[model samples]
Target: MRMFWGAAALVMVAGCQAAKPADPAVEKAWVRLPAVQGNPGAAFLTIRAGNKPLTLLSVSAPFATRTELHESMAADHGSSSGAGGHMMTMAPVKQIDVPAGETVKLAPGGKHVMLYDVAPGVQPGAKVPLTLVFADGSRMETQAITLAAGDAAPE
Candidate 1:
């Protein structure tokens, strides 16, 4: 009976232990070159959550004075207006949630990191260092390739 009780205790202890979460992954990170100083630039990437859900708290880049998460959406213009076409606007977001086992894409005309007061050194073909801060107080450092201002989204 003593041996059986010891075995049961070991099994219970193992069952109570939770599995460790996997680290998040960042891929295809790229930054758009700004037209001029003081103009905001944009960064796009694909983020994949690990075994658990992840929240992207903020983003920082050495090339920009300030960075914030932003979402671009079509503006609601009254139907009667003519010749203006459709307008798009971007708004800042506090945090972005990446679901577990799913990939969240930050692409043009969607969700992206807005870089304000861009430094002069940020240009096409330049490699920019970026840091991604998570809600869990963890940070991921990565680099993004800079593309021309008029360049389209990378394939």
Candidate 2:
């Protein structure tokens, strides 16, 4: 009947529709240009999770040939001989967990993404691309505003 055909058409149309993309889980993403060229730069951001936890597996930026996750920890003394007082140690980390309904900050002197051999084009005032890969294999594409040394926080 006509009603059956109409229902079938509606079901077919709904099936053809694409699923809505996932919600954005990143905010306040920005990159800090390295003080010296050829040195590693740093990227900071805040990540939020929805009802389920999300694991940030890795981050990638075109400006840097190699990108990795790292953490800065304060220890009693630095390995360097000249380090008299407390020194900060940085090491690579595998992943960062963003609990449900929680926010994790990737800021200075904490967990952050290290961009190695950053390209010269990624200078101050430049907007670069950053991709965050989660544990579920879903990738979130985002852009980061570059900041120079002594530059104020990005708005």
Please name the candidate that would achieve the greatest lDDT relative to the true structure: 1
The per-candidate count of clashes, in order, stands at: 0, 0
For residues 78-154, what per-residue lDDT tens digits would candidate 2 score against the true structure? 55765576678899999999887778989988999999999887669888889999998988887888999679876
Model 2, residue 117: distance off in Å is: 0.9
TM accuracy, model 2 = 0.79
Q: How does each model score on lDDT?
A: 0.88, 0.87
Which pairs in model 2 have colliding backbones?
none
lDDT for position 82 in model 1:
47
